[model samples]
Target: MSTSQTEGLLQQLLQEATVVARLSGQAIISFAWLWPIRGVLYTLLHPHVILSVSRTLFTSLLTSAIIFTVLAFFTYLPQAAFLSIFTGPLGPILALLLVGAESVFLVTFFARALFLEPALSQVFDTTLVSRGQNSLVRDGKTKYASSTKKEGIEGALVRPFQALSRDGLMKYLLSLPLNFVPVIGTVAFLFINGQRGGPGWHTRYFQLKGWDSARRKRFIESRKAEYTAFGMATMLFTFIPLVGLVFSFTNTVGAALWAADIEARENLIESPRANAPNSPKTNEGDVRAKAE
Candidate 1:
């Protein structure tokens, strides 16, 4: 990334972190209301989360199992081996770090596949309604809601898995070894995993705007720096053990807030001539009256 891009990303990261922090209390309440029975019941009643879970469960479990197995094998390696670097006095610390990282990764990995779409749908609806925007679910048959009717939920859910299966799994597995590389390894893992998590959070935004896979891919690619920063912040927050669950919920809310901001910016850019105070149309009218 360029210097300006890096700065912009850092600024955005700070902004998002602030938003997440500010809204942490609200997030806790929301999560509590949705937890245990309510969340599952809502999913059962809605096509969004249900479809996402169905599409992602197999792949997510497979990927997670593979990762766990690899980690298990490495833990059994000889003391003189490379994996043993994180052993001895530093073993507990290293174990905690790995567990934190792994927990964040697995939770986010499954969440992106299963819950993100529904969460985004729910969040975007709430955002637009609050802003007085005309937000409709699929087919315009109903307002955006928990039970909004969305077409192609199956395809939408499957796409992420396909992408993950293609190469994302391999990259994730490879990143585990990086945790052994002292300071550099952890940083690298954060960035790499953050990149993986970024798109998932942004997926709902793209859906809200009715963007297709191609457009979504292009847009995310263009704004990679910004999303990486956002994801990195999220990954760090999720590393906080018990509190990570709260952060995870807050991250969804934060993602929605971020999407709302992006949507607002896009609107301004697209309608600049219409919304401008002194545009060519106004100027031409004034000139014609003066000529008359």
Candidate 2:
């Protein structure tokens, strides 16, 4: 993809990431399955390469610390007897691996927020409204119907049914087979669910703008190819070492920015251009446009 297109994808991914991060805070407090599952779903929804890197680092540290404490408790006795099973001399290695896997999961979670949910939200707009409005409302929306405010723990369990329905369940079940497929399979499964809740938010955003589901879906789907390409491009960043880590934060933002670009272009929404004021701009057209 061209630099502009790539940047656009990143923008979109980042915007979704903010939503993903907020939703994740809710998911973490709610269900056992929500964290990693939510993580993957968030990734699909957001998929900002650079931001994912920073988020991966921040979350990996936090998650690994939690994982290590839990594993340490279990592995301590076994290792003491020299019959160590899960965490012997291999503890550090395992910890590292777990953290790495977690980083990937975090990425997947964001992506889910970026892709799956918004599309489904468009499909299930009616259901989002029909599911009885709870007493609790999110910061922006008036009622449960207008916001992606999934009711806390109680709502989490029932919410899927109201929003997703049988067809969504079928699709989720069909995706279950992918979980068995070694490393990639696990990643795929994470990616699929990560897509949830997000599109609904997008739907709400569109509703605010007097847009409908079909219009929103058409706009997003048009950029699907670009989104995939953005993922592939960011895949390159993971290969680099220390510098990659530095870039990872920006890369994720870049991913979100890319998404924003798609939204802006398709919807005729105007976000601040990258070349705004002090920001560097090599794009001749952007610079010329700004100069004019």
- Clash number by candidate, in order: 0, 62
The sequence of per-residue lDDT tens digits that candidate 1 reaches over residues 136-191 is: 22322232232245542442321222223434555555566657766567666666
User: Relative to the unseen true structure, what is the C-alpha lDDT of residue 209 in candidate 2, on a scale of 0 to 100?
Assistant: 43
TM-score against truth, every candidate: 0.54, 0.30
Give model 2's TM-score versus the native structure.
0.30
TM-score winner among the candidates? 1
Report residue 220 deviation for candidate 1 (angstroms): 1.4
Residue-level lDDT tens digits of model 2 in 1-292: 4677556645654464454444443433433222223323434564442232344455534543454455446643443344224335644443333333333333333433344233333222222222211111122134434444453311121121121343444344444444334445534433343444223223333443444458877865653333333332333332232232222333333433333333335323332544368655444433332232
Model 1: runs farther than 4 Å from truth?
A: 1-91, 105-117, 131-151, 155-166, 275-292
